[model samples]
Target: MPASTPRPVGASGPELHDHLTCVAAPATWLSPPDGRLAGGPGGLYVADRRVLSRLVVTLDGAEPEPRDAETLGADRVRFTAARGALAVERVRTVRHDGGTERITMRNDGDGIATVTFEVTAAADLAQISDVKAGDPPPPETPLRDGAVLTGPDGYEVRLEGRTEAALVLAPGDRFTTTLTVRAAPPPVPGFRPAPPDGPPPWARTPLTVRSADPRLDALVAQGVADLGALLLADEGDLYCAAGSPWYLTLFGRDALWAARLALPLGHEPAAGTLRTLARHQGTGHDPVTEEEPGKIPHELRPAYAPGRLPPVYYGSVDATALFVVTLAEAWHWGMPAEEVEALLPAAERALAWLGTFEEFVSYRGSAERLPNQGWKDSSDGIQHLDGTCATPPIALSEVQAYAYQAAMLGADLLEAYGRDGDRHRSWARGLAARFRARFWLEEGYPAIALDGTGAPVDGLASNAGHLLGTGLLDRDEEARVARRLGELNSGWGLRTLTAEAAGYDPLSYHRGSVWPHDTAIAMLGLSRTGHREQAAELARGLIAVAPAFGHRLPELFGGQARRDGAAPVPYPPACRPQAWSAAVSPALVTVLFGLHRDATTGQVSATPLPGFGPMTVTGVRAGGRTLTFTTEDGAPASD
Candidate 1:
């Protein structure tokens, strides 16, 4: 495929734009507006496998006409439809293992009605990766003995309650039945559930914001709710699953960035995430899995498959550095001193891994391994301005920024804990000096990356925005990059690549899509570098588009410019409750309120931005204490 050719969104898989999602960790239910799951990707999936492929509800052999659908919460939804004079309602609640649906039929006709409520279901037991690759699974003969559905591979889906019933209803009468779908999927060998504790860490330390603009409040509430739903437990520690439908598994980069963005909520999430990744830190080198000593694995899956990634892969170049950055930020956010000390070994290992990159952090691309190993891992993600792909070993601009930040912060942690930190500090200084001389383009902003020939692959992109707060650039250079970001702004959010670039496709995965998390990262960087106006502009863009997507941002959306009444274009296959995208809510609070805690002084500071009007935020955590703050006309005020 050519680099500029746009891959069809969702391809042969089911379309998600018109569907609704209800997710709870390892299990998720995706269905059309109507409650019926009639084949395709709209089914009950558990642990990367589809348990039920076909589930349809009918009255007298006719499907109900959908009338309304409402999402009650992260794990529950209510759908209403009608069949002639009978009004039907279905309430679904999803859990990690399975889901339950309560069906109610109310007759509103003047005359009596005879209705046969029938539910037909079947299981295919298809792997999600195969479905994503457009590969059809072999036909499986499923035996339905009463409400039990038995399929291949020891996959069993049981509808424990009543599913078929014959009823005669009088005028103004109603009938209700609850059907519980339970699945016992083949146990994944390495999968471990987090201990069943109280609510998730974010839920325990609730953060709420109320501002004059109700959209900001709604976006925050929905984002927090979505974040709580994405939390998954591993070895008694909690970390966020990347997203729903496809990426409901451990991803080092996504989990670390999400935890870092969510620091204002509390430090418990960061602590849990750090501990979880530390337990899986790479201890040896394997060419197949790309695991090197002290490196962080890119992602974790149940098992390895041919022509796919390994069970535990370490193909990413930035995750190790992000691991160090996240740990240092967690410490600054008041993660317990003892807790920080316990993870110092892992942080030290990550710093050492960064040291192995002599000049810049670069990845050797191969057909077996990821070609472009930054956050944008797409094959064609790293391209020149002319739409030609950049040959590896590619050194991404943002990876250098992350490495620089990690080295500086790692030194701080080492020094604070009475360890030698001179080496890391000196390394960071050299990185900054080299980055300035080699990465900057004649156009003023940094190049997206350096190609294999050590030539700057110049592409005007949002990647340059990440350099703002990393201290890799001087004040004047930071201002220049911030100004260039405006060219990538699509009126809704920052486009990954500027439209002027040849590879710019509004719906391309990484080339031009507007990822909320990416925009939030730039917002944080802009705010930190004293470009509050630019940060506020990006903040408003995200807030303005939140309502169109039900205030719960998705993984990414089209980079098309926003119109007067039209909503931002949806990328059909994007994950709705993505961890880092949802974490953007708290990130907004951090940027807008200028919330920061001085690690050495143990003092919290707030520098509110103008234009958000009066605002009040409660449940903010700082130095092991809950705080509340109010802003008057965008100026800081005491609670």
Candidate 2:
């Protein structure tokens, strides 16, 4: 077996773990773990541009030796370091338009200390895509006036404080100064941040969890905080930006899944995400950007490099279907009828897009587009049992499931709202039948996908787990899938691919890593299909590993099995505050309780799983009111 290595999405992007990230939507700051913005993707970025590339501090020309660092919140971090007899503390805070750092130096030695405190800063004005591709432009000297740095194209960074202060401190005395770095960049056309005065979209109706396991509580709290930090506003509505550092932008599939998983929190985020995506829904055929009428975009970037993706790319085959699914799910979670009706046209359009696909929904690759269009969309994401990459015109198994659910849900929404839905229901039936006949393998489990020639790719993968709750499979079929999923478990969580498969690299992006969102999705499906034992087992795995990663799950991790004494290995390039990954925390609460809301009645229900002990969840929103659920020793939950 090859040793696990970090593979960046870009051809030569730097790994992510080397730096600590602080984010406030459009503005993000990445620096060394010690909070110094040295080189290599460490900078203060605003709207997809690296406005400040380097910021380092020194005392008497000697840098402090970093002693400890702590993340206080998604947008704040604190670092402690020492040089000689002087102890240094730096508190960094990130905001949407700028950032701030408060530095304090204290003399611990008996004698007084005198030192020259110098701050060095520079800006590269480089595109984030170029930075991710490991081709950042050389730093440009910014015209300095006092503590501020000004660059070309309306780029300005104000470092407000004494930059070169001579400090004389007596024993036990402290010297403190605050450096506020504010940026003013040329406005990119499409992106915006939520109003600073308003609370985060998720915080409007908060969901709190308490369980017998402290780890579960900690995971939920941390995950919710991370999700709050990733929220971005588009056309006055809020949606979760995909993740920190690299992906602090709108991603259609990622945002949709995050909102859907977090439905337990409230209907606000779902409503916001649906409206935002609908506002950008595809309107014409354009091969360059892959835009087709009614197609939901793959990603929304302020700008992209030449020969790369366009600003509003519509290459995703699943986001369109997911849009309908999320809207319907949100409606079930007590979204107001007026709100649902307002978006009905967009949902209808998305359903029409689904109808354009023949037989089963599938995607064909292009030179300028992604080869695979599903969530596991890496170049080599889809492969055969023999490790050969699946060719395009590929029909992924999970995508078919998403399409089926979307069709059925769209039909339900249409009929409820007095619109004709016969065609949608008919379409869903045909899709389910085709999927059953063509996508299943002789080995008792569904294949990962069907290739260009309509042959089953025959890779035992986590994709099949998605089928369990989608209603495309029968009860027995769902049971078989739930059983097969157990084979993919790495003790910590479900692996993307089974270990017996040929291309099962534990650290590969989508080949064998454990994605928290993926595992949580499987857990939800298992619980829905009456496979409570399997769901509980996977839930326990996630809770057990939460403490190791500080109760904040990353985008993905090594799929290595958990050992009695060893912790789960980190996938170095994984995004820590990824939206979908963070949403897994709320998804866990939903799965453990087998929670659901009835669309017509506006009633919420729960069937808590056994062996989870006592658990209580408060502020769960349904029918426009807050409800609290408590279950003791696996008993039935009451609201």
Candidate 3:
């Protein structure tokens, strides 16, 4: 079906945010408290589809209750609201304030009399359903007896809804529309639970439905699921965009890498991701359009933009390489070889991108693309001590390795699973051979990457750590890279740009900070290269930080070297327990155990590292069959 056109506005309501959004991205239904979207208080009211005007509510604060109708519950409660009567009062009050609300309540107030209630709408709802539409509403639904409210930024108006004898609330992001005289009615559909259209796809990942502490689990599940929901699935290329609010669209490189870790569990969540992305593989380099032949597109359009949408930009050069990398890796983790083989054309195109997009590499060829490609492609993303960004086509290392590794590994899968024989193997060998000859530096570890003019950046960075992964290096090179990366690894994790670099700033969002996901990547790399000691230490460090700031790890964190007791503080306004970040523990678990699946044999083996504790995963299904494992000492002798 074709997409819905945005509704226009100018009829009712107060000032609203920019209603601009990408048509293909997930639709955000509410006034997103975060900043990923571009509307709200933008001087124009009622331009967006849905508007949250003022929802004024009054509560009964007479004798039996204190002025603070909602008192703190006992038993070391976290909420500031009391139990029983008071709690009911608070829910009712808050619901009234929530427009289009559905709440359950019981009234104990004075017997039916005239009760005055206020429901204000200084503006209008273009769609009434959400913020995506940019249309106007019908004149008959005007608030304040057919009068409109206009003010600075937007408008302001007061209106009234009748207080019926009893009220039944709906259960969605819907507003509260009634007042209760006798008692509150049953919940109507879609009233309290905010619409699910905007949350991430994995927001539905299930934990044990029956838990020891159902209440605690419910809250944890919400946080955990919400954390996953924040993973923006780009439908234009429905790959997971990393995290919510900010990371609200498809990113080719990120989605591929993320799914490499995510797809091991099941096909449902990652399937849409794989199929959609493969559809846009590049064909050839057209510099003006930044299109490279057979190249996979990056940054699927965000649907919630009021302006400034990042459409399916084809600027990213690395995702193509990583795309091949993920497809091959998934095969071992139980991904169907047939499914991956179907995307061979995309892989072919991705490999083609690495060679043709040379001019777009980052300064020093840091595996970066365009001045604003790759994950770190933000305008001011690359920096040194002076906050100066590197020029485009930076080639800061890593890309060559990814290119070679993706080729070799992808070929191995084709030869092994798809029965392509020697030709695939031959292509893989050629790429690896070229990578070793051109990109390697015997003395300065690896020369990071070539600058825009192809100059060497000899900075010691964590970039090589990415090599510890993908089975890219020979044993000796792996050992050397691990030792070099260790120098930049702080106790918490590996720093991105490295402390010894000219632009290293732990506080830099991507430049110097330690992201749990990044660390997880390095941690896996360490284990792969036999750096078990370092891998375990890194794994322990990450798990320790999970509960420190609400058990909600973000995409990345400030890696500022220890200043005082607090260390580098969290980047302001970062989403908590980000999607891939939440995958940290599970992926870290893989690192500690050396979990490998032999698909043809349908067996999963764990060569447990020394520190990994014993655990049991029951009723799990995998290996093209059902099996139970009681693991101990890192070995899962099947049950």
CA lDDT of every candidate: 0.84, 0.84, 0.48
- How much does each candidate deviate from the true structure in C-alpha RMSD? 2.8, 2.4, 10.6
lDDT of 1 by residue, 153-261 (tens): 6666776666688999999999998777777765557644332245676576578898888999999988888778778887667788898888888899999999999
As for candidate 1, its clashing pairs are none
For model 3, what is the alpha-carbon lDDT of residue 261? 57
What TM-score, over all chains together, does every model reach? 0.95, 0.95, 0.69
Q: What tens-digit string does per-residue lDDT give for candidate 3 at 1-639?
A: 013322212212222221111111122222222211123421111212223332323333211221222211100001122222322222221111122222223333333322223333333433322322333443323344434344323323333344222332232212234422111112322111112244443333333122232332233333334334434332322344444334445566766766665543444335545676776565655554365676766655423222233344676757777777777666666666677677766666665555454332332222333465655555555553344555555664566667667767766766765554354345546655655665567564765555565545556656677778665578888888877777766666777766766666665556677777778787888887789888887766665555444445556666655333443355543433355665564465466546667767867766666644554433223444433444565564444
| Reference-based lDDT, residue 70, model 1 | 95
Superposed Cα RMSD, model 1 = 2.8
Off by over 4 Å in 2: 1-12, 140-150, 190-197, 304-307, 364-367
Q: lDDT per residue, candidate 2, 175-263, as tens digits?
A: 88877777776565564444234567457556778888999888988888888888888777878889877788889999999999998
